[model samples]
Target chain A: MTHQDRGAADGTPRLLRSGALQLETGGRLPEVSLAFRTWGRLNPDGSNAVLVLHALTGDAQVADGPEGAHGWWRGLVGPGRVIDTERYFVLAPAALGGCSGTTGPASAAPDGQAWGSRFPFITLRDMAALEARLLDLLGLASWHTVIGGSMGGARALEWAATQPERVRHCVVIASCAASTAEQIAWAQAQTAAIRLDPAFRGGDYYRHDDAPRVGLGIARRLAHLSYRAEPELESRFGRAPQGAETPLGSPDRQRRGRYAVESYLDHQAEKLVGRFDANAYLSLTEALMSHDVGRGRGGVDAALGQLDAVEFFVAAVDSDRLYLPGQSEALAAALPGKPGVEYIHSSMGHDGFLTQAEQLEPQLRARVFG
Target chain B: MTHQDRGAADGTPRLLRSGALQLETGGRLPEVSLAFRTWGRLNPDGSNAVLVLHALTGDAQVADGPEGAHGWWRGLVGPGRVIDTERYFVLAPAALGGCSGTTGPASAAPDGQAWGSRFPFITLRDMAALEARLLDLLGLASWHTVIGGSMGGARALEWAATQPERVRHCVVIASCAASTAEQIAWAQAQTAAIRLDPAFRGGDYYRHDDAPRVGLGIARRLAHLSYRAEPELESRFGRAPQGAETPLGSPDRQRRGRYAVESYLDHQAEKLVGRFDANAYLSLTEALMSHDVGRGRGGVDAALGQLDAVEFFVAAVDSDRLYLPGQSEALAAALPGKPGVEYIHSSMGHDGFLTQAEQLEPQLRARVFG
Candidate 1:
């Protein structure tokens, strides 16, 4: 099925460009259009399948989509790319409990009402389960590989652990085995920002005024900072004045948000608010905060022991603050038998997977495709 | 002035324990007490003075106090230490917009009303101004040094730039020249959590039933995670069980907040609530969000130019998520004339200044005393 847009003006995921398909969230809402795209042709028997999961704000279009030619993983998924779609049937699905297609707070209900705040909370595992169902519907049993980044990486890990027989390989990049207190805290903080926006109206913004765009903007700005490095920010906008004047007063006399950095944050906020759903952001953020694959599996060490059969290819960003590169190292170490792990050195904090496509491609090809 | 507890359960900044001083936030109810302890006999000249600023949720007593000498930085402030009380005449005052022994929301006002939600918004510079006034009240002239970490480091940067003559040396550790979009976002998130709490009651929780402890807990948990290393968490927690079993189900079958790491986060949350005021936390967190040394300067590079005369010792924590070491590097690079910079490697995140006291002491002594 070709991916389609669901009346969205600025697209679904903050990063995704197109391919909106509807899916059921199993909540109060009906099936929601999920925006997704596929890379590489589906081989006969579909045994050469590789599922690519996106992070908290990721979508289906991994690298190039059919009509939406622009690829998220531009250099990594084409021709002889690391995740060469040409060689494998690659499926990048919008995560469950997300704003993109799959039933989320933005989906319409049987009553012709948008789910809005009526959506039930979902967990990382729930998202993985939804993907499993989608696989079943597609008449394909996972065989080749499962790859994910950040939150996507977490889902990939869960898929490997929960359904070991479904796949032959696993590639988790720039993500943790379970959400850390720090990750949970960051997620909680983002969730609160959306909720605090006066317009949020307790997730009932749909029926009321516009979404908590300001709050969501602020949230996006914050996440953007974590997604990139301090040096990168400095190199790009080191306190230069915006085209506008400083709002507080004279420079050297007052203190306020005057630098270009501040302006950059403002721009980010504006972009996110215009494109993303506040409730979906909050719900997905909460799901990330609640993620803990090893919660009931003894401890992280013991829990990792459950994935004895999985082949691991983990990646970490050197300058990532959200998912510190060291977490990747630890995840690799904790697995029963040490799994192959690597680092994707980049100044783009946790979003390195998208930006460092060239570096990640080889890793994906050697471990997953080979 | 003898620092002794003026016995009163009233939540006021009191000269509780030894060297503790009590004062109400100006024009507010709930006279808060500031439990402070002075180090080194204040020289008759008072000019041989150094002010050690603490980060958010930090108190005045850096070492021993009536509360059995509990302090976050016990290693750096003792006799013959880096900030040796014997000669340097050091003063570490609780910040004005704080929950500890200071006029904060939880403190009872003269009218028996807790400032709660009534406190005015404050900025980082405003906080420094209050401390400057405190210095004036103490009869101190030019301070020999202004040393701080994290938010405290921001204060030090402000002191040297805003009051260049007053501070001869500025020691900034694990801090940024300005709060990045990401940092502000994190602060906003924490604020939202507290504000959204029904118990927060618009910050007047004292008059209401529940304090926004859950929200505050969540905030602290997030902050604590930022202050420590990602790998450290994996090594320490790694999904370890909390020793006890679930009453509702078998330990093996249980799925809840069962990990020791989760318990550790709970402990941190409880500790903050036991001693901190939620309103003060909101204020300080906002202040941090608003922190920007380059706000009114020509630019970040131009802002650093203002520090031409001030001596600087820049430090960074390798694992700190909030204040990445790269920030220090950027600040050092921006400084017109190259300044001495130190990178302190530690597993502890931003809190490395407190947790790795032994490693910090010699550095503090060499920089502050030498």
Candidate 2:
């Protein structure tokens, strides 16, 4: 229920306090800890190890979400699945700014208080760097395949660009080499939505009586809409009123209930409200906004040009509006071998990368496991 | 300053309150009134009068902002511009659920109090019907040309189908015969944003000191982003910082400033908050959500098929993501002429229909005025 509870290293999520770490934004952290979960065992040679990264708001629970827990990418990772936990060692770590078992704004600083507004802005490269340390701690010299989608894909691409030798294969899905200005604009609106809430109280609302639930709900609603394609929403809900509730409210009262799509979005908002942290959402979105694989490497092409050693597979959801297929095509065009983008056709938009892995399984298997 | 100031019949902005109006949802409005402005002079037979419709958040201001007031289509509606106010008598009405000089949620009812939450949910057809009443008041028999973009485009299409005899030449830009499911979903998100704002007060926040500006701002931000194309933003801002103010804020504080694109959206939001009412925003947004020209006319084909009496020119922004060009094509195909979609090539996306009149000038003149 509190930031400390998640940062306390509950045994279900093992924690490691990584020594001193310097961030990409020129800020230094005296101590950093990451919460992670591993599936399958690492072979003696470490060649069988595979690192699977989670997207924004996703956690280390890649597959095995027993009980009532929800896993982000359950379709692709598990026993006998495309990821095949039985054959390959899979390690999933909560991203640096993630609230679920990760060292985020909610985590305690060296002074033993929640970082709150003091947590420095981190980037995807910083996440990639910290993840490298986590890999070293596990005695894995190099990852056989570093796979992820969306923000996770940013990290995977960052690793492949800055340190390809450490990754034998890279799979980037539903992501571009850099966050577009439009993407930043959307991220900024979401962050502004959270910050403008009176309940948010400057990202220091950890112990406040009322958190930014309303604001966060609005943020989630906006995000959920963007995550799916318009065609999907049209086909799914159209103009149907929710249940028998009329969309009409009196001149003296508020409008009642909603259209089915509104209810669906509200459901999405509530689900995130119970589990996700607003500050963490803000932090990760900033990190995503800062995502540029070519920031210091001249340009995207030159940056990807340095990843010749990493076998790469670029994939995109054909219906994706958030991360359009053109982005994946652009990424593939800049990659070492100029590989064609593998398209996963679905009505789900950008979410197809996480939900429709059946279409992606063969391509991933051919590139990474074949 | 007050709704009545705009609602009261002054010479510049003409206002009329019709009695006993029934809404699309079967609700009854004891009185319905609209604010409107007209340019040029109507001919003896009213054949030279053109009806111009405004999009969501737009009022009767189609052109001629003498001061520095921001006219939505100022560039395209001047003495000798595309719309040519000098020659054609152009009449624009503030939509029924509008705030600008219109009888909307902010307007006082028969009880002499702000309608606020009590305002009825009106539809695009209802708006067209009301506008028809306004035309009757002005003693205009029929319009020579009917043109609009976006939601105005929706109104134009509705006018063409539901009352083809009233419209001689119809030019629908960046809209379709029906509100697509995707459009509804986006609208739902905007309405939810207003509702979630604690300050919104269930649409009755007119007299409150705080009036859901944050939520409205968020809604505007979401809408403005969609109004523009992603590639345009990427080309213009491209992850650039706003001046030298960084995106990084301390762990104990909120993010300081914004990226260039973020600042742009913020500016757009602030502008709307200053001049627009949130409840009216919600009302007009609902009107847009219910904009299905096909409703009661069977399907889209049947509805568009009924518009044989009116000559139609369907135009779409080549880069529009919100109202795709395909929707325009479908609308044109359903019409008796089967007109090919007129493409306005620009990076402006949906806004292209408003901003890129230079590119569309010759085509529009040839199709609608020829």
Candidate 3:
């Protein structure tokens, strides 16, 4: 009946507990626990293991469960699918600062209180290090492929850059070598949105009756818009009023009905706010903002040049406005072998990394898993 | 000094008080006032008077004053500039729901209290109608040209569509015939940010010592990002820390310094929040959300077809992400004569309409103001 036992009852993510962990910022977490889900058994050599990282706001659940419950990447990560879980031991760990049963701001501290505002700042490097620890605990020496998209892609690239020998193949999709100024600017707005909410209480709202749902909702709406293509939004909802609602002519602004697009954003906001923690969102967003594969090694070109031992597969969503395809091209061009950037033709923008991931099946199979 | 007398002594905007003004949404303000500034003397025939409209966050001051005060559009509206104030009488009216000298949410109602929550919803058409009333008061029958950028562009287009005979020339820059789904989505986030601030108090915070400055700041930050180009930001502030402040490695979130881009956004937010009213921001944003020249006039092409007598010159910023160049192309294609869309080349995104406007000088001279 306790928090740690709840997941075990149902076929949910299992926990990996570890001792004090040091962060890249010279801060340290007294204890760390990662919630992870695994599919297929690892081979005796452990070379058939695949590490699947998730993007911001994404959970450890990459593929469907035994009952066929839907997962975010179900299309490419199921039995006999592009990833073919039947042949590979695929593992997906909820991000370190995530709300999905991971050691995040909402998790308990040594004082038995929620970490909340006291949680230390962690970067993508720190996140990758923690995942490495999990891999060590799982008796896995190396990964056949470390693959992801968006923030996940950044993490996958980090895995290859930091521990080149551990990852034989690295697939990064719809991401860049580092967070661009525009990306940082957007993150600033989102984090500001959450912080401006009075209910947020400086990232310590776990004990409060109400969380910063409104602020979190606004952040999600903004993020969702960036995730999709403008043309797709226009084609799907262009100036259309929501069912039975008039978006214009209302004398009272409060009484005015919502536009179809506004309604769509509201739905997206509600879905995220209902399940995610505000502090976790801020933490994860800040971490993504700190993403820089070249931070200590050198510039992006110098850092990527050192990854000769790791085979690289870089892909970009053609319509992605958040992470421009040019970034992916630059990342590919900077790699040791100057790999050609793969294109995922989609009208879904950055989210195409997830929705149109199937488009990269042949490329992924030939260059990565195969 | 009283609010009405303050502007009179300083060569500031002059106010025109009027009786109940009917709005497009069927609402009526018992008393209405428009603050406007004029350059140059009106000819005896009143045929040389040009209407220059300001975009969101801009006011009646379109050109430098006698004291040499700077104006938002000073470059193109000065003595011998493109819009030449010396040759043609130029008039700029503060928008109806603005926080400038014009009557708005912070303005006193007939009952001697701030309108605040009681302020009725107004659209671009309604705003144009008020300017029309201002023209009627000035004894001008028509405009030599009606020109503007961004929201002003929308208003100018509305003028040509609703009262084509009144506008001899219509120049719309970086604007579309209607607010796209993506634009609405962005607007929804901004309004939501303001509304989420507890200090907002259901839009009735005018009398409070503290206004919704935080909410307004967040809104401005989001807006400022959308107004500029991505590459411009990347090239200007690529992961640079602000001054001596470190963007990473601070254990406390509050103590952490900002990324250079974050500092830039903070400055933008602070500048706007200090001078603008949160309610006015929301009002104008929602009004923009209702921008559609074809609302009740069949459709875009049909509405534009009715404006055959009004010469059109449309322009778009090549790097504009908010209002894409394609939207301007579509707008130009829908016009009666199908004027080719002029491109304003700049690295400054949608703001290029203001910054790179000089690029269209020859075209504007030969096709529009000429």
Number of the top lDDT candidate: 3
* Candidate 1 structure quality by residue, lDDT tens digits, A3-45: 2222122112422222333222232223434445555566667
Best by TM-score: 3
The DockQ figures for the candidates are 0.13, 0.47, 0.76
| Candidate 1: chain B TM-score against the reference chain B | 0.86
Q: Write the per-residue lDDT of candidate 1 for residues B1-370, one digit (tens) a residue.
A: 4313212211123352222222222232233344444666566666667788899988887655544565577677666667766676666778766866655556665567776666655566756665675566565667889888888899889888778878888888889898875565455556656765667777766866667887787677667766777667767765445688321122111132345666777788899888887788887876676677876677677888867778788888877777877778989888756674676778777777777655766665666677
Q: All candidates' lDDT scores? A: 0.67, 0.80, 0.87
Give interface RMSD, every candidate, in order: 8.5, 2.8, 1.1
Question: In model 2, which runs have C-alpha deviations exceeding 4 angstroms?
Answer: A1-13, A26-31, A65-71, A109-113, A248-253, B1-12, B16-22, B26-33, B65-71, B74-87, B248-253
- In order of DockQ, best first, we have 3, 2, 1
- In DockQ, how does model 3 score against the reference complex? 0.76
Reference-based TM-score of each model: 0.72, 0.90, 0.96
TM-score of chain A of 3: 0.96
Q: Per-residue alpha-carbon lDDT of model 3 for A38-112, expressed as tens digits?
A: 777666676787889999999888988756667789878977887887787788889998899779999999999
Model 1: DockQ vs. true structure: 0.13
